[model samples]
Target: MDAVHVHMTNTSNLPVEALENEYPLRMDEYAMIQDSGGAGRTRGGMGIAKQIRAVGPGIVFSARSDSHTVGVAAGVDGGRDGRRARLIRNFGTPQQEELFSKTANIALAAGESVRIETPGGGGYGAPSARPQPRVAQDVADGKISAEAARADYGLSA
Candidate 1:
């Protein structure tokens, strides 16, 4: 299997110091992608996007899925679904950029950074087929609002 690996150190007062001390590089920022989940009957697993701003010049390597389009996960029988993954960066730039490569390796400067958008899980069945308890749990967990869950998932939450 293919994978992306990153090495960095932290120079700030953030909790990342431990990582920096443990690693051989420094990092200015790190975060996951916003929303990249899929929708399907069984709900495919969500993709993961990570970004790290280099505190200094360093090399970065990443491997990700090539399918930038989000697709509905195949449901067991019939269930509501989830959305796909979409990646965007430098939205204000005169021209939009799309990074659909399965692997990326580059040297970044202090102010340079990369954004990764992962895919979300797919729905298991028809939206109305989901259980009320599941919908309620989603609401409680802040994954979905009560109104949305009720209207979309047909739950009482």
Candidate 2:
């Protein structure tokens, strides 16, 4: 074994009081990305999807997360690859812009919103090895989609 320890900082709902009611940064409003985890017996930890609506003018945002593609967590035997991070600015606006995993001072004006999706962890084994009841629970909890439950865990006819 090597002398190394790693830690991942959860950027979800980052506490920023400056953007409080002034920017309507709803910290409690986070959802799990549906079907975002890798397929495997030991289901990968779900990722967090959050959207913040900026209300004040001249607001700046900064973030850094695991990258998609190369940085995606590698799955175990028979387990599919996990999803990677994503960031979207001005999601519904004509000025919408897609950003990289790490971004520096970005200006966000009034009425603009940003959506951030953190990466999911890698799976452990074959998806089919996962229980049907667990898949159903995931669906009901909105962590994974119904289609994923059926396709990944073979819970549907």
Q: Pick the candidate with the highest lDDT.
A: 2
> Candidate 1 residues 52-125, lDDT tens each?
44445564645455445534434445643443444443223454455554546754455454555444454555
Candidates in order, TM-scores: namely: 0.54, 0.78
- For model 2, the superposed segments whose C-alpha errors exceed 4 Å read 1-28, 92-95
lDDT of each: 0.46, 0.71
Alpha-carbon RMSD, each predicted model: 7.3, 5.1
Maximum-TM-score candidate: 2
lDDT per residue as tens, model 2, 1-157 = 0101122455333355654744545443467776777878987777776778766677788886657435786789988776777888877669888887678898877777788776777778999999888888778877778888887788884
Question: Could you tell me how far off, in angstroms, the CA of residue 4 lies in candidate 1 after the best superposition?
Answer: 15
